[model samples]
Target: MKYSLASGLQPPFTQRESFVRSHPDLYWRNKGIAAYEQNRATDAITAFRRAARYADKPSQAMIAQMLWVGDGVPMDRVMGYVWADLAAERGYPAFIATREKFWHELDRDEQRQAVVVGQAVFDEYGDEVAKKREDKALLLARRQITGSRTGHVGALIVSLRLPNGDFETVDGALYYADKYWKPEQYWEWQDSLFEKLPEGKVEVGPLQMPPKR
Candidate 1:
């Protein structure tokens, strides 16, 4: 089916004034969208990617859409999934449902690549969220940063015998405990899984929120 950027599936980023003003490539993208509607697949794919190189959010989502449906280019399942996933992460609700549908359609190999991407983003950012909540800062980081949770299985627990003194694996994915850590101790392992306890106390969630005014 032909997809329209004007449809409800279209996101808001494309409407940003700066997005249109700053991207010279958008001309080609607009042309390509028109061409695709007219059944010009090859031209549309070429134009879409050209636009996407400088695209902020909406354009990226549209490119992913084109790839997802094999509209303008040969269907590359892995790339398509990644692009669509990215779009969804950026608050593109339309991408959420479609990306999920495409995920299930992928072969085993394609699914595995998605898993790797999933693990990397989660492991690196999960602790950050926990830290923010712990600080009890008034401002909340946009959920966009934590959006990656939508993907699949996180990292595994290796052995707690590495040189780092923390049984962590950098090979596949990194999954630290969801809990917090206490101050230093010899054998007192904090909330984390490591060779030794953390050097200082690391709290997750609002460990110290001052009393309300």
Candidate 2:
């Protein structure tokens, strides 16, 4: 389900801020898309990198595309392959295909370089590290909303705006549905937001490569 604020009801600014903070992967990914569409390649890359830190697969793919063609950053096919491989970790078919394509495009030297750079990338942005970062953010967001470390404070009523304009008033302990509270569920939900790409089509495919200076 698409997690968004109520359409009709305007939530407090702080509440909206808290919501964005809780799901930074989504925020930065969307921000990257906007910047990219506006031709702000540098800003888009920066935003996508931040999103990748939270395990945003699409953002990871986008970063790989930009880095591959030197759109905003220097061309580094090795690092591009590394990011593509990272994006493919969860076995998404599109991402997996893209990763393979990147590998096939590389020479033996670049492949070796990719393996080395991949280790460093994984140490920082792999699911093991990235998921923990997002989990901590979610935990902190829940604490702020429920005002309790355990996400419970007896009879605390938390009203959440549902997609259909209805408000679901739930206990503080249950305020965040599994999709928002549980890291795995949250990742799945976010994954669902990705549109299915055509076979052999990378969603963030490279444009024409810029001429070398």
The ten-residue window of minimal lDDT in model 1 covers 178-187
Clashing pairs in 1: 134-205, 159-167, 160-167, 165-195, 166-195
TM-score of each: 0.42, 0.71
Residue 95 local lDDT, model 1: 46
Best by TM-score, which number?
Answer: 2
Model 1 ranges with Cα > 4 A deviation:
1-3, 6-22, 115-213
Best by lDDT: 2
What is the C-alpha lDDT profile of model 2 across 19-105, one tens digit per residue? 566787867887887788778888989998999898888788888878887877899899989998998887665666678888999
lDDT of 1 by residue, 1-213 (tens): 233343333223333332233233345567666666677777766676555443323444566666666654777677677766654553334445556767888999889987777554334222333223322221111112223433232453323344335443322132222111111220122111111223565332211111212
What are the Cα lDDT values of the candidates?
0.44, 0.72
lDDT of 1 at 62: 63
Question: Which window of ten consecutive residues has the lowest lDDT sum in model 2?
Answer: 1-10
